[model samples]
Target: MTNPSTLPDFDHPPGTDLWVFAYGSLMWNPGFPFVEKREGLLRGYHRGFCIYSHQHRGTPERPGAVLGLDRGGACRGMVFRVEAAAVPDVLRYLWQREMAYRVYIPRRLRVRTDQGDVRALTFTADPAHSQYCGRLGLDGTASLIRQGVGQSGRNVDYLSSLIDHLAELGIEDQGLRELAARI
Candidate 1:
């Protein structure tokens, strides 16, 4: 796993645009400015409860499960187009917010959308990280989410918010839906 600070800063040629793929909280709260957004499809990675949050959603005593883009299948998410001038600031914020613990790998991946294909900055799951929870079953996952709380508030709120946003996008995540129902 690479520390976000250790990674070189993101760079783009002048006039080149920046794009970001939002599969989780980012969809609801991007925390940055973007020129446009569209529904997008990313292949080879799907959202799953693969990370145990030790800061935002739960504590070390009883970790909460958070969504990560694990390998396989495909993910339907939002792609945000950012102006070139804002790339540096946006990348800095995203690095601090999503890469604080190096639980995710910062990558530029291709996403297909109604607007066409776009190369977007995306954070992918780092299975090697200590926080990785692997493939915990739904019931076990739900149980943890039910009881977990951290600086960000209740884990159930996180799950429910994601479910609501996915519903608004007309995207169905059966596992998450079932888990949300149980919660």
Candidate 2:
């Protein structure tokens, strides 16, 4: 494994030391070649159902909320250390994958890892552009999580995987738990 700190400086030409934050699908599939992955934390930001689905993950006609890093609490995810030479190609791929929703706005974030904290680029919800499912209560959210269908796949599977992943990490989400129980 390459030491992220030792990689050639990307600040000049190649743009080395590129770090990416993976919250949802990216956690399981980054779709990029990375040198290292570490369990990391983002402070002052927590995952929320803030983004409305369009085409990327779900159909625009029947949209749902995907995870996004919103202000408050903390977010636990993975940090990917990518090669500088691969930044452009990787970024392009991400754009293509994420363009459908138009809910995410890429930004630089601070990631805390066992090695150390690093500033990395990550995508977050665009409040003005994203769909806030605040009206959806526990039952409604659980029902949506259990039965909604999307382009990516079934909403149940998506929620299941997220719940399972978080459970494996010893993180409990009451909303997710209720959804799982309903299913």
Candidate 3:
């Protein structure tokens, strides 16, 4: 297996099949075409706001939070199966959208799919970057989730979308649910 620590070359040649793991905005708005999508879980990693939001999901004047993969827990997201011929174009789109945060380091992630686990490319937080928010307590997190009008739209929308998606897959995030109630 290729080392997961190294960054992926987004500019792969044509005919290379690409699998992308979507955890946040990409989950809801992939902004790219894919041949298939499946419910997948990633181990040894979880979703958090390790990256700061300055645009897209947040504004420079009133920034909002976006997702950054952190080194703990398990994350449930969608695994996109892209056609080999479209790998280069699709990857470029993903890189443009995800790299907006600039604090993320793209790496290969091991995702558990229905067919079994597969290695896929995904973005994770770079600890050294200034955008890293780290982990937040429930209350602190709820506050941001409740008021989501800064850069990336409403915080409620982000949480609600994730909750809805999880429900569709019969999965639950107790922490997120509890925080949503408070919101």
Candidate 4:
């Protein structure tokens, strides 16, 4: 469990648009409204199944894997630009959805898009967090995905959903595909 005080605060003035990067479930189902969205590439971090999901996709006893933006490499994902007025509601929703375990630390990083560069808010795994698994071997990851079920449903379904969404975005992740096939 993470202390609420540890969560990062999003304090932005009114009338300032905010950009958010979505690499996992948010890629498919962003509950918040946004004015614009674009495919973005974030360097210095890669999306990997490096966190043990003990709430949404599994229990503590049988944890499933969830995607996290870990150090190194790069990630291709969707970037959403929310109008300033909508930022508050979006932050509230994201906090409830992604900050539960505090496994992810909210961050503002630069993302490259066709329109140019923008600083976007994103989540990266807290390597020190108890749920952080760093990088797990493919087989071990597959086993967890095969057995996990939680509030959001089957862990395998989550993985499948991510894979499907990636494909739809014209993003090819061989590592994720291999992990999915390994099971």
Candidate 3 residue 78 Cα shift, in angstroms, is: 1.6
Give the number of colliding residue pairs in candidate 3. Answer: 9
Q: How high is the CA lDDT of each candidate model? A: 0.84, 0.69, 0.71, 0.86
| TM-score ranking, best first | 4, 1, 3, 2
lDDT winner, 3 or 4: 4
Q: What digit string (tens of lDDT, one per residue) describes model 2 on residues 26-121?
A: 877788899988988888777765555554345667665567776678888889988888877776677667644456666777899999998877
Against the true structure, what is each candidate's TM-score? 0.88, 0.77, 0.79, 0.89
TM-score, cand. 2: 0.77
87-132: candidate 3 lDDT, tens digit per residue: 7677667666766546777877789998988778888887788767
Cα shift from native, residue 29, model 2 (Å): 1.0
Model 4 TM-score (2 dp): 0.89
Candidate 1 accuracy as lDDT = 0.84
- The per-prediction CA RMSD against the true structure, in angstroms, equals 2.8, 6.2, 4.4, 2.6
Residue pairs with clashing backbones, model 1: none
Once all C-alphas are superposed, what RMSD does model 3 give against the true structure? 4.4
What does the lDDT come to for candidate 2? 0.69
TM-score winner: 4
